[model samples]
Target: MAIFLTGVTGYIGSYLAAELLEQHGESLNLLVRAEDSQEAQRRLWRSLQLHFGFPVFHEHLSARIRIFCGDLTSPRFGLNDEKYDLLVSSTDSVLHCAASLNRKSEKSCLNVNLRGTLEVIQLARRAHDAHGLRRFSEVSTVAVAGQRRNEQVTEDSAIDWDRSDYDPYARTKKFGEHLVRELLPDVPRTIFRPSIVLGDSRRPETTQFDMVRAFVFLGGLPVLPFRPDDCVDIVPVDYVADAIVTLHQSPRPKYEIYHLSSGVNSESFRELTAALAEARGKMKPLFWPELEAPFRAIVERLSRRRDNLGYTASRLEVFLPYLVWNTVFDNTRVVAELRRAPAPFSSYCFSLFRYAKENRFRYPYREWPEIATLPSTARDSEYSESARHVSAGEPAK
Candidate 1:
């Protein structure tokens, strides 16, 4: 009875597989997309190194694994009918994690997020009819909560607005969830909705993006644009992984949509900026209160119309909506379930920023369009120059 998994190569999927290997132990047929056999092994090995490190996969578990290559967008997962039929007759669980993360368009989102998910369900229904598989699980997002503006957004709360049916990404996740709900009524199912997935809390190995970038962007600037009231939710990747394991391992209730989130740890935009400044920039907490009234006056004047602001001004204009407003989400249901389970650990903006700054770790989250343009301060020039000459600087033999 193996778990048939998809998205084994993605950030969340990679970590999830590691956890599953530890708890569920190897009985997995991972779905991946690779050009050829060699490349597939290379990709799997590389991903294993990131999670379990060097010696490839963690011991005792490597031999129990298997791989299946296919595109989620294709029917029967792009596998030939013979193979598909065999898969249909074998696996016990389908953990559908593959989805197009592209935020660029609604149609692309629908194709991968919605239709691709339906394809997995179609297969699951066939597999259940054929082999009597046990459960189908999906990795959805807290964003499916969609633009709600309040605290304590509980699991029982009705989706006030069908935000998913509108926003490209949200719609895809929502629609995908819909497919699973609609077609697989008899099969056991679990839907997990995680909030902004952060990097590893302990190892710091990461690729999930959002908060880190925002903090990095602020740290690179000379001035901190202070807005003390706006907030963003942060949740660690480990927590999401842990929650899934908990839900799966437990006698999960039927048709449960669990919001696996931080539940607390709300960071106001100003506090977040201050943390990054303190962590990486080693800058002081000098809020420009004197500039506030004037800044507001300027912003108010510019907001007379959508196109009132010029190119530079409009860029700021476009980004301003995020700065001034955002609500919070709640996760009591999952938290209550995971009362004793290891809680998710998000970065202490200050601590993470400080470590990254002191260690001179690349501010990877920050867009570097003007990195080359910024004149090298006393901080970088000589270090940059000397670093280029390996011949002059002999190895520490």
Candidate 2:
């Protein structure tokens, strides 16, 4: 009877949750990684607080949200029989937004992206068999295109089994897409592949700062190591989340897969740097494509240190390939469906850059308020008991 959503604790996932709760009428079944219901509530608050105050979040918590305390890597999401059965029987749709984005670690990518997705697929199968599922949506990334350069990739042309991937993250995600199609042949499905999702276009505040830190590092450089005209595909989280929520809920979306990206309209390094320079009243950094090899060596060396510079270099090292790729995913399908285009990164990049720098590359998170009380809805009580019993190795009565 509710929409089963994963990754509610993540950045983009949190936006999706807020959009669904505020703009639509579907109750949400969120699978959170926690030992019990209380911890799950706190985690949800930590992420959802970016969108609203404690009062509104708690109201939604009591009215529409059901917390399923579990892990994606666990079999059946680690939910006991009664709880898992309740989950399947009460769910008519699925939105799999959870994935491990650790591009450096094959082990992390394998366990989370591959194994975790399999568990979500298995749940969709059960729900479909019990009563036909409405839809299944998977939030994928544009990196699945794999080792592209100076090319505009379309939705259908993005995947080629023979092409080499940039990292373990891309490799596993490409295969993960194959798993959904091969295993869930009968379920209605939609795949959303977003490219370089950065800050929100509507606001300067953001909870995720990995990519921002990398951008800041690059911006502070006097002499860069890339071509000035190379276009980098970047889309704001607001547009990506909006496209996903709209298409996922549509009864007959025009296409099964959509590219939530800037596509051909993506700004080049020159344009992006110029905007930032004007905002900060500083001259643009010089670009020298010939220095790429030497710059890469320096970055690799710096990434080994155990200081703040090393931290930034490490983040940049992981994303260096993406920056130099000069490839963009075509957004024709999404633009047609949504009847609007993503705001260019140049329009909002300065605000995000300034905010990240001012905050020391960390989001100022507020602690859970002491006055808040546990949700008292009947379903909340039932799930709370189930979570406690699961954690204590007892059966829920």
Candidate 3:
């Protein structure tokens, strides 16, 4: 058996590829885009091998792994004709994890998110189902639920278009979902919708766009308007990888989509700031209008010198969005699935934060513990009750 994985060079793909090498008796044909196929393939091998910190990374098993240099937008992954056919036939599953995650570029997002997904689905249908091509697992986003203000956006929800249809990226993801649902009605499809993926789980080593890290970083300084209840759905990268792998191990549902979020533990803006602050030993609890007065003055004074001030001001880039915004991911489906097969919640839960602080991969603070012991203040906080009471689906009191 072979697993054809796209975006093998990416964060999630790297972890997934390593797991595949460890768990299944299958080779991985990773779709890579590079200037030269031969050199590119070798580079990817070295990367995946070095990243496998465990002694388990089988160095001699290089024969089982192969790499194909190709662009997702190109015909059959832009491979030469023979390689294309070989790829189409040799794999038992295609994990379509490649995509343009640029939040700013709508057109690019649509091209990769919508059209790219359609292409993956089409190619999979061409494979010999009799030969055991079991599935096409798509990496979607919880954003597809869009602006369903307070609607319990379940896997069964009809993918509310009005909310999803706005952002080009969301529109494309929703479109991708539509395409998969329209497939042969026989082809097994699994959609995993993960919200904001955060730091690496086992260690703080991270390559994720963790806005939470930014907010946490900002927390130490005098920023104002920081509330305790604002929150967002931040799941550790390992949990995201594990959930995707978990969804695969379970019996394929007739049709299924799992929301790969931190589930109900979704942090509010304040709670998030508090967590990072608590991790750093400087969690703020009340309004500080006076603090902002001097802070803005310092910034305004600094803004004058383009070279010096601009350089210093960029320091605030990580914390710019700390004041507001919360994206609560309803993971009812994902939670039930997790409970059925519990892996230590500690692996991805608050322990990950401890790993970050200890290694200095994130917040430059004292280690809460060798394994993070969520501080009593943080542990006792009523943020969870507040996060749930204000759950996105329920009516406000």
Number of clashing residue pairs in every model?
Answer: 4, 1, 9
Per-prediction TM-score to the true structure, in the order listed: 0.74, 0.95, 0.73
Q: Rank by lDDT, descending?
A: 2, 1, 3
- Please report the TM-score between candidate 1 and the true structure: 0.74
Task: Give the runs in model 3 whose Cα sits over 4 Å from its true position.
Answer: 45-50, 53-61, 128-132, 148-152, 164-166, 209-213, 224-227, 253-255, 283-327, 340-397
Global local distance difference test of model 1 = 0.61
Judge candidate 1 at residue 265 and give its lDDT: 54
Candidate 2: list runs displaced more than 4 Å: 373-397
Which of the numbered candidates is closest to the native, going by highest lDDT? 2
**Compared with the true structure, what per-residue lDDT tens digits does model 2 show for residues 245-317?**
9999999898888999999999999999999889889999999999999999988999999999998888889
Top candidate by TM-score: 2
Give the runs in model 1 whose Cα sits over 4 Å from its true position.
Answer: 54-62, 161-166, 209-211, 222-226, 253-255, 284-325, 340-397
Query: Which ten residues in a row are the worst by lDDT in model 3?
Result: 378-387
- What lDDT would each prediction earn against the true structure? 0.61, 0.90, 0.59
lDDT value, candidate 2, whole model = 0.90
Question: How many clashes would you count in candidate 2?
Answer: 1
Residue 152 of candidate 1: its Cα lDDT? 52
lDDT of 3 by residue, 129-228 (tens): 5475677788888777765433335666738755434356666787888888787467677898877676665664554424434433444454554444
Looking at candidate 2, what is the lDDT of residue 372? 49
